[model samples]
Target: MRILHKQQHLPPLDGPRLEPHPFRAAGMPPDKSNGAPLVPVNRREHGLEARRTDMAADQRGEGAAVNTEHKDGDRQPPHGAHDAFDFRQLGKEDFEQFEALLRYAFQVSSSEMARIGWSDREMKLSKKPIFEASHVMGWFYKGRLASQVVIYPMEVNVQGEICKMGGITGVATYPEYTGRGLIHSLLAKSLEYMRDQQQIISYLCPYSIPLYRKHGWEIVSDKMTFAIKDTQLPARHPVEGQIERVDIESEDLHKVYKYFALQEHGALIRGALEWEEYWRWDSDDVMAAVYYSVDRKPLGYVIYYIENEVFSIKEMVYLNQEAKYGIWNYISAHFSMITKVEGANYTGEAMAFQLEDSEIDETIQPYGMARIVDVQRFMEFYPFQFSDPRLTLDFEVKDPIAPWNNGIFHVSWQDGEAVCEQVATCHSGHRIALDIQTLTTMLMGYKRPTYLYNNDRIDMDYHLLKTLEALIPPDKPYFSDYF
Candidate 1:
């Protein structure tokens, strides 16, 4: 990897040439100040002594001035000189500083907190679980946290294969420190850490699509919201299974989701951390209903609540056609109790086409993005569809963040098996070209090879394009979880 010094003369890799988007928070400074209430640290990973020993080296060089590539254009440095700061992984001890940066960057107002039932007491109690579950790192100036990013060690089902994934969230920076390349350094270090830990893929919900695109992330999934009137609700479909309402933390709900996630591609396997995030903002009025077979086996569930004459569904998962009909049968029973039903679909397909009444209103928007952390490891585990004669292809990958992924990847498939390797140069004619983001989304089956080439996101010859289309399966990812 190349050092992150200013103006390093590294040759640019081959790929599409789009002008870089300036990294800025946009608009006026946040209304809140950097002073946040102190957070109580609990469940510390290491004792105070061991933590200090591990962080001592990172904190030793606080007084030295360091300059890296400013992702945006050159702006005048603060105080007529570059800021002297330290970069290190955050632990439980740094909770106060980390919380401050998040509040300042996101501008969490008192009114917003009250609406969501957030109080200072609850906020303080939330610190322990977050620190225990996430990997946090930040840039500090004079011992004060200025910028931060959090990575959740998680797993997701990718085309029936359980892949170790790094889920990135809570990224923030102070407005004054925007153009100093602080985020660039943090992102580079984050990618390197994910590679070493064997997290082959990474995903994030982007606040700015263009900003993350420059850093090697592309859209991989979408969220669809649909509304159906009481008259339009699916006509009750009879089934042997029956719906049973249960507690929000029912074990039956967990069992149903576990089976569904395992069988469904691109679904999140919820653990304790994911469950916490799932119900974090909901009120006590929310409840869950699970579909049980006549044989007493749980098959599907829906977490929902009725409010303001509207039946709102947070999530609904089903294992088979019986479960799907049984769950909807429960919702149809509520037709006399509510005016309409509103819910979201994470599967990249339209619900209108499936519903008996195809006139319901629906809208779709991009939800999450992903990037390949280690190209070699990702291709090795990837399940590419293979047929007759052997297929060989070589293409250059241009990754802006991780240098190890910025070389030519040579791949071949034969005898119902596929293998890949990265080399300094392509052995065959450069038949295709892609960036890390495009490759990730393409292989994940979110976007097909032909769509990418037609959209000018990939450069491929006529023959190579057809081969990729056949080699890749057609299954759009079904990701609905947020962080």
Candidate 2:
């Protein structure tokens, strides 16, 4: 790919157009003194190091000028620099450091050191000269990468509209530097960069909830966890099929997954890159197996293996009733060797009901938290009826962490359609105010809007409260994969 310095000319790629959203802490300078006035950094202009320097300075003192040199005259570490920290952009040359930082940050094994996995190669190439060095950012201290964050350009189908968005991941901070504000600086700069790029929205799988909310994000989606007990495995089979496991090198597994993706509502269309990443995990440690039909035909598949005699289902995809039954029976028959099978997703039916005795544990873990970085964009993407009568309602989105989301929105509907507009007050009707975070939670169907209102995170009039509940569709938000 050709690199361009001026933003005016560049090859087009699939990504969101970002608008700058500068962050000024309370009582912070109104002046644009945050380093070089926020230059857009991307493949066009790779000035990430300089940009970080300026932003860190601003965050440090709000008005302090950035010092381009290491502490003291020499580049030696600060005397108390063990705790004293500075931020730097991790160059491609720092892969070893990046890998080390990741290993320390996440406490995973050295499986990442393998030579030929998709994620492994991505990490390797990310540090190579040929790779396009855009979309990822990291923060370092004392010549060591302490905390890191990465944003990849992507798109998501929100409501019914496909919107350009960014998926943030690899958020890991070194053990010793957990509470030292490293993540805050990294995220502030990342958000600023995302805004400048005109990314209408951003998504991330959070390590914690309240932290990201403070920086201007709202939860937009969630995943439900389900458990199937061996006792629930029913005897009667609905469809005639045989269950078999194919060799890892066989070509039939792809066919099974391809068929599965076509039928599932929330399944991701995994390309070669995604497939490689999935299969790259250590199979011995985590059973990575696939399912096939009785007539030597591939119908359904699963990517999982037993751990500690507890059969963990990392993922299971079946296109039709036969495949689902075949796969479930195949796994359940192994009850002698396994204790249970567990996973999470948004499914129309409970896992236990399909089993023999229907005696299973239904444990739902909310996975993949999302935030609406842009409220107007989020509202615009909302699908509403266009053929009915018009009705107007008020919405008070109280987002303290990201004030831009904290405001009143007038929603009007007619002919089975809806639209939103900003409003200042509500005099003749019901009123409500919910923190943007709570609203995010409500949006994902994790909790009821009225429940949030009762908790005081949301305030609204009775009628408006009912309307808000009605406005939000009752569907469990589902994200099957992590970015």
For every model shown, the clashing-pair count is: 0, 32
Candidate 1 lDDT, 290-351, residue by residue in tens: 99888878888899999999999988988777888999999989978999999989988899
Off by over 4 Å in 2: 1-91, 111-134, 140-146, 157-161, 174-180, 196-201, 216-231, 240-269, 276-300, 306-311, 332-350, 385-389, 413-418, 423-430
**Reference-based TM-score of each model:** 0.82, 0.65
Predicted structure 1, TM vs. truth: 0.82
lDDT per residue as tens, model 2, 262-307: 3332334455544544554444555434544455566667766676
| True lDDT of residue 328, candidate 2 | 68
* lDDT value, residue 259 of candidate 1: 72
Whole-model Cα lDDT of every candidate shown, in order: 0.73, 0.53
lDDT of 2 at 272: 53
